[model samples]
Target: MAGRIAAVSIVEAIAADLRNRIFTGDLVSGQTLTETDVASTYEVARPTAKASIEKLVAEGLLDRGTHKTARVIELGPESVRDIYLARAYLESEVLRRLARDKAVPGDAVLANSEIAALQSGAPLDVVEPDMRFHLSLIDAVGNERISRMYRSLVGEVRMCMVRVQSLHLLDNALIHNEHQRILELIESGQGDAAAQLLDEHLGRARERLVAAMGGTAGPEAALPSTLD
Candidate 1:
């Protein structure tokens, strides 16, 4: 039992480390991972490393081979578009429901908190909080299935964000302003307008990520990876 627990811990640790590398783009798409290399680096056994890689493969963040080889899954244009499409559908539904039902009395408070956290120039836990904010809306809809799927999708989205190295806290005056506006629309029961604003906001964010990754943008253009 002790050995099993230890093995699970090792595998989870390795999985998290590799996930971070993949998210930060340090392990780019198509980069192969060898069990031998990972075992040596993480000081774990080959089986443990294999387990870690397999976990990520199941998460759709890594691709596995017939043998024990694994590689980071690359996001092509279509994959990117599909991701946004899923997000748009889910978020728009949540927003529409919230506006119609007037659920979640603290919309303004949550939005203000997020904006203040972003503007404070402090390292924001953007990924987790972003997931929470969106999920909160889905939960308000009282749909178990949609919420479950949204949670699953959030994991994939986070993986993509990590792959693009786009979760850092930075000063995007425009983003801050945009977020504020969306919050205002939601608060005022303008579901349609809020949904439109969210779509545009997410689109701009995606564009900035692509531009930053392609080296078309300046240093401040890319999202930072560090929590702080």
Candidate 2:
């Protein structure tokens, strides 16, 4: 039992480090990882390294082809559009609910503060905080299923952010301002307006990312315009 526990811990630790490497672009998209290479680098058994890679694969970060080697998943234009569209739909509903209930998410405010603190030019620095702010808004809805669905897409979301930043396409100050405005609109009980702004905010980011990835933005998909 003790050995099993220790092995699980080691797997988790290795997985965490590999996850960070993917997020920080140390492991670029389409780069393959062999179990042997990971075992040698981390000084772990091949099975342990395999388990770590499998964990990331389950999280949607790593893709294992038929050959069973893991490679970082690429976020092409279609992927970028779908991810942002899903996020916009999910978060738009959350905003409407929060607005109707007049519930303000404090964690979102804290995340915005973190975003504000970063230097304006460092787009990568704000990605996690920006993601946190949106996650906080969804969590504020207090629906476990909805939050789970949203989180399932987060790995791809972070990958998209990394690409967006690398292309120098994000504006830190603008994001902060937009986040603050969305919160204020929710606070004022303006559900529809808040949802609209949230949709527009996400839509712009999605289109820009799609365009940067060499894809044309399609017609806007409609979200629920009002709370149920």
Candidate 3:
């Protein structure tokens, strides 16, 4: 039991290191990872490296198949459009419900902190704070079904964010202010308005992502949110 626990710890550490690389763009999308390479690089046993890869695979950070090494997720424009549409629908409802109930998010401070970090250009995981903010919204609702569904979709969301950042589609100020608007609307108890703004905010991002990928804009990406 002790040996298994120790091995798990090692796997977590290695996986964290790799995960950070992926988050910060050191490891680009579609990069391949192999147990042998990880083991040699980290000076750990092959089994340990394999365990780490499996962990990342479960997190949706890596995709492993029967005969191929795991690769970082590479999403196309259509996928981005689909995922953000789902997020916009689900997360806006979370805000609307909370707004209607007059309930404050316990993690609101942390979510605001992320926006501040983006505004200040603080050194961060680059995409982690954004993920945390969205996930917090779903988790705070205390619904297992919604939380599980959101969690499962986070990996793809992360990919979309990476592309957004890399393309500089929306500047820090845009992202920060949009988040602030969402919070303000929720605080003012305007549930439907908040939901609409949230939809438009995500829709702008979706359109930018699709355009960056050389794809056509879908109906859901038709919001006119200004990025400048």
Each candidate structure's TM-score, on Cα atoms with residue i matched to residue i, is 0.72, 0.90, 0.86
Q: Provide the overall lDDT of each model, using Cα atoms, as 2-decimal numbers.
A: 0.67, 0.85, 0.79
Q: Candidate 1 lDDT, tens digit per residue, 25-78?
A: 678888998889898998888889889988888877888868757888877645
Candidate 1 least-lDDT 10 residues: 219-228
Q: Whose lDDT is greatest here?
A: 2
At residue 214, give the lDDT of candidate 3: 87
- lDDT score for residue 112 of model 1: 43
What are the per-model C-alpha RMSD values against the true structure? 6.1, 4.2, 2.6
Model 3 Cα lDDT, one tens digit per residue, 66-183: 9889999777787787898888888988998878876667586476576666544423444667677677777878999999988877867877887787777766666667777777
Mark the regions of model 3 whose C-alpha exceeds 4 Å error after superposition. 117-126, 218-228
* lDDT of predicted model 3: 0.79
Q: Which runs in model 1 stand beyond 4 Å of their true positions? A: 1-6, 105-115, 119-128, 139-142, 159-171, 207-228
Q: What is the lDDT of residue 174 in candidate 2?
A: 70
What stretches of model 2 exceed 4 Å from their correct place?
120-123, 217-228
Predicted structure with the largest TM-score when compared to the true one = 2
Residue 155, model 1: lDDT of 46
